[model samples]
Target: MSEADYSRVSPFWQIEFFYCNSYLQSHSLYAKISASESPMSEMVEVVIDSIRVHLMAPQRVVVLKQSSTERYLTIWVGPYEAEAITVALQEVEMIRPLTHDLIKNIFNSFGARITRVEIVKLQDDIFYGNIVADAGGREIHIDSRPSDAIAIAVRAHVPIMVHRSVMDAAGMEPDREVPETNAPLARQEPPPPPSSDDANRLSVFKDFLDKLDIDSPDKDKPDSP
Candidate 1:
Protein backbone atom coordinates (compact mmCIF):
# COMPACT_ATOMS: atom_id res chain seq x y z
CA MET A 1 0.00 0.00 0.00
CA SER A 2 1.25 3.48 -0.89
CA GLU A 3 2.10 5.79 1.98
CA ALA A 4 -0.83 8.01 1.14
CA ASP A 5 -3.15 5.08 0.66
CA TYR A 6 -2.01 3.56 3.93
CA SER A 7 -2.75 6.81 5.69
CA ARG A 8 -6.15 6.93 4.11
CA VAL A 9 -7.08 3.62 5.78
CA SER A 10 -8.86 3.66 9.15
CA PRO A 11 -6.73 5.00 11.99
CA PHE A 12 -8.19 2.66 14.63
CA TRP A 13 -6.59 -0.41 13.06
CA GLN A 14 -3.24 1.33 12.57
CA ILE A 15 -2.80 2.00 16.29
CA GLU A 16 -4.73 -0.99 17.57
CA PHE A 17 -3.41 -3.86 15.46
CA PHE A 18 -0.81 -4.95 17.96
CA TYR A 19 -3.32 -5.02 20.79
CA CYS A 20 -4.25 -8.57 19.91
CA ASN A 21 -2.08 -10.13 22.59
CA SER A 22 -2.94 -9.84 26.29
CA TYR A 23 -1.59 -11.18 29.54
CA LEU A 24 -3.36 -14.44 30.40
CA GLN A 25 -6.14 -12.84 32.43
CA SER A 26 -7.20 -16.02 34.20
CA HIS A 27 -4.39 -15.59 36.71
CA SER A 28 -4.78 -13.24 39.65
CA LEU A 29 -1.43 -11.52 39.31
CA TYR A 30 -1.40 -7.81 38.48
CA ALA A 31 0.79 -6.23 35.83
CA LYS A 32 3.62 -3.81 36.51
CA ILE A 33 5.33 -1.68 33.87
CA SER A 34 8.90 -0.43 33.81
CA ALA A 35 10.03 1.16 30.60
CA SER A 36 13.71 0.88 29.69
CA GLU A 37 15.93 3.10 27.59
CA SER A 38 18.59 0.42 27.34
CA PRO A 39 16.96 -2.82 26.22
CA MET A 40 20.18 -4.85 26.10
CA SER A 41 20.77 -4.36 29.79
CA GLU A 42 17.12 -4.53 30.86
CA MET A 43 15.80 -7.37 28.71
CA VAL A 44 15.86 -11.09 29.48
CA GLU A 45 16.21 -13.42 26.51
CA VAL A 46 13.40 -15.96 26.02
CA VAL A 47 12.50 -18.71 23.59
CA ILE A 48 9.17 -19.88 22.25
CA ASP A 49 8.07 -22.64 24.60
CA SER A 50 4.77 -23.51 22.98
CA ILE A 51 1.40 -22.40 21.69
CA ARG A 52 -1.41 -23.69 23.91
CA VAL A 53 -5.16 -23.79 23.78
CA HIS A 54 -7.21 -22.90 26.86
CA LEU A 55 -8.51 -26.49 26.91
CA MET A 56 -11.90 -25.29 28.11
CA ALA A 57 -12.17 -21.87 26.53
CA PRO A 58 -12.06 -20.55 22.99
CA GLN A 59 -8.67 -18.90 23.46
CA ARG A 60 -5.14 -19.72 22.33
CA VAL A 61 -1.98 -18.61 24.12
CA VAL A 62 1.66 -18.37 23.05
CA VAL A 63 4.18 -19.14 25.77
CA LEU A 64 7.72 -17.76 26.02
CA LYS A 65 10.27 -19.33 28.31
CA GLN A 66 13.24 -17.46 29.72
CA SER A 67 16.22 -19.01 27.97
CA SER A 68 17.99 -21.57 30.14
CA THR A 69 15.51 -20.75 32.91
CA GLU A 70 12.25 -22.03 34.33
CA ARG A 71 10.09 -18.93 34.22
CA TYR A 72 7.62 -18.52 31.37
CA LEU A 73 5.59 -15.66 29.89
CA THR A 74 2.20 -16.55 28.53
CA ILE A 75 0.18 -14.14 26.39
CA TRP A 76 -3.25 -14.71 24.89
CA VAL A 77 -3.47 -14.21 21.14
CA GLY A 78 -6.32 -14.16 18.67
CA PRO A 79 -6.98 -17.34 16.73
CA TYR A 80 -5.57 -15.83 13.56
CA GLU A 81 -2.26 -14.56 15.01
CA ALA A 82 -1.96 -17.76 17.03
CA GLU A 83 -2.31 -19.84 13.88
CA ALA A 84 0.10 -17.54 12.05
CA ILE A 85 2.69 -18.13 14.77
CA THR A 86 2.17 -21.89 14.78
CA VAL A 87 2.45 -22.05 10.99
CA ALA A 88 5.70 -20.11 11.00
CA LEU A 89 7.23 -22.19 13.80
CA GLN A 90 6.24 -25.46 12.11
CA GLU A 91 7.54 -24.11 8.78
CA VAL A 92 4.31 -25.14 7.09
CA GLU A 93 4.75 -24.34 3.42
CA MET A 94 1.79 -22.22 2.46
CA ILE A 95 0.92 -21.74 -1.18
CA ARG A 96 0.64 -18.01 -0.44
CA PRO A 97 2.20 -15.52 1.96
CA LEU A 98 0.42 -14.84 5.22
CA THR A 99 0.28 -11.33 6.66
CA HIS A 100 3.38 -11.84 8.80
CA ASP A 101 5.28 -13.62 6.03
CA LEU A 102 4.54 -10.69 3.79
CA ILE A 103 5.99 -8.36 6.41
CA LYS A 104 9.20 -10.38 6.57
CA ASN A 105 9.40 -10.32 2.78
CA ILE A 106 8.83 -6.57 2.89
CA PHE A 107 11.73 -6.16 5.29
CA ASN A 108 13.94 -8.26 3.05
CA SER A 109 13.01 -6.25 -0.03
CA PHE A 110 13.91 -3.01 1.76
CA GLY A 111 17.17 -4.30 3.28
CA ALA A 112 15.91 -4.28 6.85
CA ARG A 113 17.61 -7.10 8.74
CA ILE A 114 15.60 -8.19 11.76
CA THR A 115 18.01 -8.47 14.66
CA ARG A 116 15.79 -9.27 17.61
CA VAL A 117 12.22 -9.08 18.92
CA GLU A 118 11.52 -7.82 22.43
CA ILE A 119 8.55 -8.02 24.79
CA VAL A 120 9.29 -4.69 26.43
CA LYS A 121 6.57 -4.00 28.98
CA LEU A 122 3.35 -5.16 30.62
CA GLN A 123 0.63 -2.72 31.63
CA ASP A 124 -3.13 -2.91 32.05
CA ASP A 125 -2.82 -6.62 31.34
CA ILE A 126 -1.40 -5.91 27.92
CA PHE A 127 2.01 -7.10 26.75
CA TYR A 128 3.91 -4.56 24.64
CA GLY A 129 6.74 -5.47 22.31
CA ASN A 130 8.75 -4.28 19.34
CA ILE A 131 10.79 -5.41 16.33
CA VAL A 132 14.32 -4.02 16.06
CA ALA A 133 15.97 -4.08 12.67
CA ASP A 134 19.15 -2.89 11.00
CA ALA A 135 18.55 -1.25 7.66
CA GLY A 136 21.60 0.05 5.86
CA GLY A 137 23.50 0.77 9.08
CA ARG A 138 20.50 2.51 10.62
CA GLU A 139 18.39 0.92 13.34
CA ILE A 140 14.58 0.90 13.25
CA HIS A 141 12.10 -0.15 15.92
CA ILE A 142 8.52 -1.11 15.18
CA ASP A 143 6.09 -1.45 18.08
CA SER A 144 4.19 -4.74 17.99
CA ARG A 145 2.20 -7.11 20.16
CA PRO A 146 4.17 -9.86 21.87
CA SER A 147 2.36 -12.46 19.78
CA ASP A 148 2.97 -10.67 16.48
CA ALA A 149 6.56 -9.85 17.47
CA ILE A 150 7.09 -13.50 18.31
CA ALA A 151 5.59 -14.62 15.02
CA ILE A 152 8.08 -12.43 13.18
CA ALA A 153 11.00 -13.51 15.36
CA VAL A 154 10.48 -17.20 14.67
CA ARG A 155 10.29 -16.57 10.94
CA ALA A 156 13.48 -14.45 11.01
CA HIS A 157 15.24 -16.90 13.34
CA VAL A 158 15.88 -14.15 15.88
CA PRO A 159 16.12 -14.15 19.63
CA ILE A 160 13.16 -12.92 21.71
CA MET A 161 13.66 -10.70 24.76
CA VAL A 162 11.30 -9.68 27.54
CA HIS A 163 11.94 -6.86 29.94
CA ARG A 164 13.05 -7.91 33.40
CA SER A 165 10.28 -6.02 35.14
CA VAL A 166 7.63 -7.41 32.84
CA MET A 167 8.88 -10.89 33.54
CA ASP A 168 8.85 -10.23 37.25
CA ALA A 169 5.30 -9.00 36.94
CA ALA A 170 3.65 -11.66 34.78
CA GLY A 171 6.14 -14.48 34.48
CA MET A 172 5.16 -17.71 36.20
CA GLU A 173 6.77 -20.97 37.24
CA PRO A 174 6.48 -23.94 34.88
CA ASP A 175 4.50 -27.09 35.61
CA ARG A 176 6.06 -29.62 37.99
CA GLU A 177 7.09 -32.00 35.24
CA VAL A 178 9.77 -31.13 32.71
CA PRO A 179 9.48 -31.76 29.01
CA GLU A 180 12.06 -34.20 27.73
CA THR A 181 12.67 -32.13 24.62
CA ASN A 182 12.75 -28.52 23.35
CA ALA A 183 9.85 -29.24 21.03
CA PRO A 184 6.62 -27.27 21.65
CA LEU A 185 5.17 -27.88 25.13
CA ALA A 186 1.48 -28.22 26.01
CA ARG A 187 -0.63 -28.77 29.13
CA GLN A 188 -4.04 -28.22 30.68
CA GLU A 189 -4.40 -27.04 34.28
CA PRO A 190 -7.57 -25.09 33.74
CA PRO A 191 -6.42 -21.74 32.36
CA PRO A 192 -7.65 -18.50 33.93
CA PRO A 193 -10.80 -16.98 32.47
CA PRO A 194 -10.27 -16.03 28.88
CA SER A 195 -10.08 -12.32 28.15
CA SER A 196 -12.84 -10.75 26.16
CA ASP A 197 -11.87 -9.47 22.73
CA ASP A 198 -11.83 -5.73 22.41
CA ALA A 199 -13.21 -3.98 19.37
CA ASN A 200 -9.66 -2.93 18.40
CA ARG A 201 -8.61 -6.56 18.04
CA LEU A 202 -10.13 -6.51 14.57
CA SER A 203 -7.03 -5.36 12.73
CA VAL A 204 -6.64 -7.53 9.64
CA PHE A 205 -3.00 -6.90 8.82
CA LYS A 206 -0.19 -5.46 10.87
CA ASP A 207 1.18 -2.54 8.85
CA PHE A 208 4.28 -3.46 6.82
CA LEU A 209 6.73 -0.58 6.79
CA ASP A 210 10.48 -1.40 6.65
CA LYS A 211 12.41 -4.58 7.52
CA LEU A 212 13.57 -7.89 5.89
CA ASP A 213 16.61 -10.21 6.15
CA ILE A 214 17.73 -13.26 8.09
CA ASP A 215 20.68 -12.37 10.32
CA SER A 216 22.96 -14.93 11.91
CA PRO A 217 21.95 -16.54 15.22
CA ASP A 218 24.81 -14.81 17.04
CA LYS A 219 23.71 -11.39 15.82
CA ASP A 220 20.17 -12.25 16.87
CA LYS A 221 21.21 -13.01 20.43
CA PRO A 222 20.22 -10.77 23.34
CA ASP A 223 23.76 -9.49 23.84
CA SER A 224 24.16 -8.53 20.18
CA PRO A 225 23.57 -4.99 18.99
Candidate 2:
Protein backbone atom coordinates (compact mmCIF):
# COMPACT_ATOMS: atom_id res chain seq x y z
CA MET A 1 0.00 0.00 0.00
CA SER A 2 1.18 3.53 -0.73
CA GLU A 3 2.44 5.53 2.30
CA ALA A 4 -0.31 8.10 1.90
CA ASP A 5 -2.92 5.38 1.42
CA TYR A 6 -1.54 3.52 4.49
CA SER A 7 -1.85 6.67 6.60
CA ARG A 8 -5.46 6.91 5.56
CA VAL A 9 -5.91 3.25 6.56
CA SER A 10 -4.41 3.54 10.09
CA PRO A 11 -1.90 5.98 11.54
CA PHE A 12 -0.48 3.31 13.90
CA TRP A 13 0.20 1.13 10.88
CA GLN A 14 2.20 3.96 9.40
CA ILE A 15 4.43 4.31 12.46
CA GLU A 16 6.73 1.60 13.70
CA PHE A 17 6.54 0.43 17.37
CA PHE A 18 9.90 1.72 18.53
CA TYR A 19 11.37 1.54 22.06
CA CYS A 20 9.56 3.27 24.93
CA ASN A 21 11.41 5.06 27.73
CA SER A 22 9.51 3.21 30.44
CA TYR A 23 6.62 0.75 30.61
CA LEU A 24 4.20 3.36 31.90
CA GLN A 25 5.34 5.85 29.32
CA SER A 26 4.99 3.06 26.80
CA HIS A 27 1.49 2.37 28.09
CA SER A 28 0.57 5.99 27.57
CA LEU A 29 1.87 5.61 24.05
CA TYR A 30 -0.17 2.45 23.53
CA ALA A 31 -3.34 4.26 24.62
CA LYS A 32 -2.71 6.84 21.99
CA ILE A 33 -2.16 4.13 19.42
CA SER A 34 -5.35 2.32 20.38
CA ALA A 35 -7.33 5.53 20.20
CA SER A 36 -6.03 6.19 16.72
CA GLU A 37 -6.91 2.65 15.70
CA SER A 38 -10.58 1.70 15.82
CA PRO A 39 -10.47 -1.92 17.04
CA MET A 40 -7.75 -2.96 19.47
CA SER A 41 -6.13 -6.35 19.30
CA GLU A 42 -5.96 -8.55 22.43
CA MET A 43 -2.50 -9.96 21.83
CA VAL A 44 -0.66 -7.97 24.48
CA GLU A 45 -0.04 -9.30 28.00
CA VAL A 46 1.65 -7.78 31.07
CA VAL A 47 2.62 -9.00 34.51
CA ILE A 48 2.39 -6.95 37.71
CA ASP A 49 5.65 -7.52 39.55
CA SER A 50 5.46 -4.97 42.41
CA ILE A 51 4.47 -1.53 43.74
CA ARG A 52 6.65 1.41 44.82
CA VAL A 53 6.08 4.47 47.04
CA HIS A 54 7.70 7.64 45.75
CA LEU A 55 9.31 9.84 48.43
CA MET A 56 8.18 13.04 46.72
CA ALA A 57 4.50 12.38 47.44
CA PRO A 58 4.29 9.93 50.28
CA GLN A 59 0.86 11.24 51.22
CA ARG A 60 -0.60 10.91 47.75
CA VAL A 61 -0.49 7.67 45.70
CA VAL A 62 2.01 4.97 44.77
CA VAL A 63 3.48 3.61 41.52
CA LEU A 64 3.09 0.08 40.14
CA LYS A 65 5.19 -2.00 37.79
CA GLN A 66 6.02 -5.37 36.35
CA SER A 67 8.82 -7.13 38.22
CA SER A 68 10.85 -7.66 35.10
CA THR A 69 11.26 -3.98 34.11
CA GLU A 70 12.43 -0.66 35.54
CA ARG A 71 9.56 1.26 33.94
CA TYR A 72 6.55 1.90 36.17
CA LEU A 73 2.84 2.67 35.81
CA THR A 74 2.02 5.40 38.32
CA ILE A 75 -1.40 5.98 39.83
CA TRP A 76 -2.73 8.77 42.02
CA VAL A 77 -4.52 7.12 44.90
CA GLY A 78 -5.85 7.91 48.37
CA PRO A 79 -4.05 7.24 51.66
CA TYR A 80 -6.11 4.14 52.30
CA GLU A 81 -5.32 2.73 48.84
CA ALA A 82 -1.65 3.42 49.40
CA GLU A 83 -1.65 1.66 52.77
CA ALA A 84 -3.54 -1.31 51.42
CA ILE A 85 -1.25 -1.78 48.42
CA THR A 86 1.87 -1.23 50.52
CA VAL A 87 0.95 -3.89 53.05
CA ALA A 88 0.00 -6.33 50.36
CA LEU A 89 3.24 -5.78 48.46
CA GLN A 90 5.59 -5.89 51.49
CA GLU A 91 3.63 -8.61 53.28
CA VAL A 92 3.98 -6.42 56.36
CA GLU A 93 2.02 -6.88 59.57
CA MET A 94 -0.88 -4.56 60.25
CA ILE A 95 -2.77 -4.40 63.54
CA ARG A 96 -5.96 -3.47 61.74
CA PRO A 97 -7.31 -4.62 58.39
CA LEU A 98 -6.32 -2.30 55.57
CA THR A 99 -8.76 -0.97 52.97
CA HIS A 100 -7.66 -3.52 50.36
CA ASP A 101 -7.86 -6.26 52.92
CA LEU A 102 -11.39 -5.19 53.73
CA ILE A 103 -12.28 -5.22 50.05
CA LYS A 104 -10.97 -8.74 49.69
CA ASN A 105 -12.81 -9.78 52.84
CA ILE A 106 -16.05 -8.28 51.61
CA PHE A 107 -15.64 -10.03 48.29
CA ASN A 108 -15.15 -13.37 49.99
CA SER A 109 -18.02 -12.78 52.41
CA PHE A 110 -20.40 -12.02 49.57
CA GLY A 111 -19.19 -14.97 47.43
CA ALA A 112 -17.75 -12.55 44.90
CA ARG A 113 -14.35 -13.28 43.41
CA ILE A 114 -11.94 -11.28 41.29
CA THR A 115 -11.12 -13.16 38.13
CA ARG A 116 -8.59 -10.82 36.59
CA VAL A 117 -7.60 -7.22 35.91
CA GLU A 118 -7.70 -5.95 32.35
CA ILE A 119 -6.18 -2.59 31.46
CA VAL A 120 -8.87 -1.88 28.93
CA LYS A 121 -8.62 1.70 27.74
CA LEU A 122 -6.63 4.91 27.83
CA GLN A 123 -8.07 8.31 27.13
CA ASP A 124 -6.88 11.89 27.58
CA ASP A 125 -3.67 10.77 29.30
CA ILE A 126 -5.52 8.55 31.77
CA PHE A 127 -5.38 4.73 31.78
CA TYR A 128 -8.41 2.74 32.78
CA GLY A 129 -8.67 -0.76 34.27
CA ASN A 130 -11.46 -3.23 34.80
CA ILE A 131 -11.89 -5.80 37.55
CA VAL A 132 -13.58 -8.96 36.31
CA ALA A 133 -15.48 -10.54 39.19
CA ASP A 134 -17.76 -13.50 39.54
CA ALA A 135 -20.53 -12.74 41.99
CA GLY A 136 -24.02 -14.17 42.48
CA GLY A 137 -23.43 -16.48 39.53
CA ARG A 138 -22.78 -13.59 37.17
CA GLU A 139 -19.69 -11.72 36.04
CA ILE A 140 -19.45 -8.04 36.93
CA HIS A 141 -17.06 -5.26 35.96
CA ILE A 142 -15.79 -2.51 38.21
CA ASP A 143 -13.45 0.42 37.52
CA SER A 144 -10.20 0.53 39.49
CA ARG A 145 -6.76 2.10 39.63
CA PRO A 146 -4.06 0.25 37.72
CA SER A 147 -2.10 0.19 41.02
CA ASP A 148 -4.98 -0.96 43.23
CA ALA A 149 -6.27 -3.27 40.55
CA ILE A 150 -2.82 -4.82 40.33
CA ALA A 151 -2.43 -5.15 44.12
CA ILE A 152 -5.81 -6.81 44.44
CA ALA A 153 -5.06 -8.96 41.43
CA VAL A 154 -1.95 -10.27 43.15
CA ARG A 155 -3.91 -11.18 46.26
CA ALA A 156 -6.75 -12.71 44.27
CA HIS A 157 -4.22 -14.74 42.24
CA VAL A 158 -5.64 -13.50 38.97
CA PRO A 159 -3.83 -12.67 35.78
CA ILE A 160 -3.00 -9.05 34.95
CA MET A 161 -3.16 -8.11 31.31
CA VAL A 162 -2.57 -5.11 29.05
CA HIS A 163 -3.74 -4.35 25.56
CA ARG A 164 -1.25 -4.99 22.74
CA SER A 165 -1.88 -1.58 21.27
CA VAL A 166 -1.10 -0.13 24.67
CA MET A 167 1.96 -2.35 24.92
CA ASP A 168 3.16 -1.27 21.54
CA ALA A 169 2.73 2.36 22.52
CA ALA A 170 3.80 2.10 26.20
CA GLY A 171 5.70 -1.17 26.72
CA MET A 172 9.43 -0.90 27.40
CA GLU A 173 12.32 -3.33 27.35
CA PRO A 174 13.07 -4.58 30.91
CA ASP A 175 16.28 -3.42 32.55
CA ARG A 176 18.23 -5.90 34.70
CA GLU A 177 19.69 -3.29 37.08
CA VAL A 178 17.78 -1.71 39.95
CA PRO A 179 16.18 1.64 39.31
CA GLU A 180 17.41 4.69 41.29
CA THR A 181 13.96 5.39 42.67
CA ASN A 182 13.59 1.78 43.80
CA ALA A 183 16.76 1.85 45.88
CA PRO A 184 16.55 1.36 49.66
CA LEU A 185 15.34 4.49 51.43
CA ALA A 186 17.38 3.99 54.63
CA ARG A 187 20.05 1.82 56.19
CA GLN A 188 18.92 -1.64 57.25
CA GLU A 189 20.47 -1.63 60.73
CA PRO A 190 21.33 0.86 63.48
CA PRO A 191 24.68 1.19 65.26
CA PRO A 192 25.40 -1.11 68.20
CA PRO A 193 24.62 0.13 71.71
CA PRO A 194 27.39 1.05 74.21
CA SER A 195 27.57 -0.98 77.40
CA SER A 196 27.27 0.65 80.81
CA ASP A 197 30.10 -1.53 82.20
CA ASP A 198 32.44 -0.34 79.43
CA ALA A 199 31.54 3.28 80.17
CA ASN A 200 32.27 2.85 83.91
CA ARG A 201 35.61 1.14 83.22
CA LEU A 202 36.65 3.92 80.81
CA SER A 203 35.74 6.56 83.42
CA VAL A 204 37.93 4.83 86.11
CA PHE A 205 40.82 4.44 83.67
CA LYS A 206 40.65 8.18 82.81
CA ASP A 207 40.76 9.15 86.49
CA PHE A 208 43.84 6.96 87.20
CA LEU A 209 45.57 8.21 84.04
CA ASP A 210 44.88 11.85 85.00
CA LYS A 211 46.84 11.35 88.27
CA LEU A 212 50.04 10.38 86.29
CA ASP A 213 49.93 13.20 83.77
CA ILE A 214 53.46 14.51 82.75
CA ASP A 215 52.05 18.01 82.05
CA SER A 216 52.08 18.72 85.82
CA PRO A 217 55.40 18.79 87.87
CA ASP A 218 55.56 16.77 91.11
CA LYS A 219 54.59 18.87 94.22
CA ASP A 220 57.42 17.27 96.36
CA LYS A 221 60.15 18.35 93.81
CA PRO A 222 58.68 21.86 93.30
CA ASP A 223 60.43 23.40 96.38
CA SER A 224 64.09 24.55 95.94
CA PRO A 225 65.61 21.61 97.75
Which prediction has the highest lDDT against the true structure? 1
RMSD of each: 16.8, 25.4
TM-score of each: 0.62, 0.48
Once fitted onto the true fold, the runs of candidate 2 whose alpha carbons sit more than 4 angstroms away are: 1-43, 53-80, 174-225
lDDT of each: 0.70, 0.55
Tens-place lDDT digits, model 2, residues 1-225: 555665575546435422333455646421222232222257344554333333344433333354444544434556565556556655676788766677778888889888777776655546677666787777666777666777787677787766655544444443478456754668545658758864553453244323432343342121211
Model 1 per-residue lDDT tens digits across residues 61-151? 6767898689877788898888888787767889889899998999899888999988887777688888888879976667788888888
> What ranges in model 1 sit over 4 Å off?
1-37, 175-225
lDDT of 2 at 26: 44
Deviation from native of the Cα of residue 3 in model 2, angstroms: 70
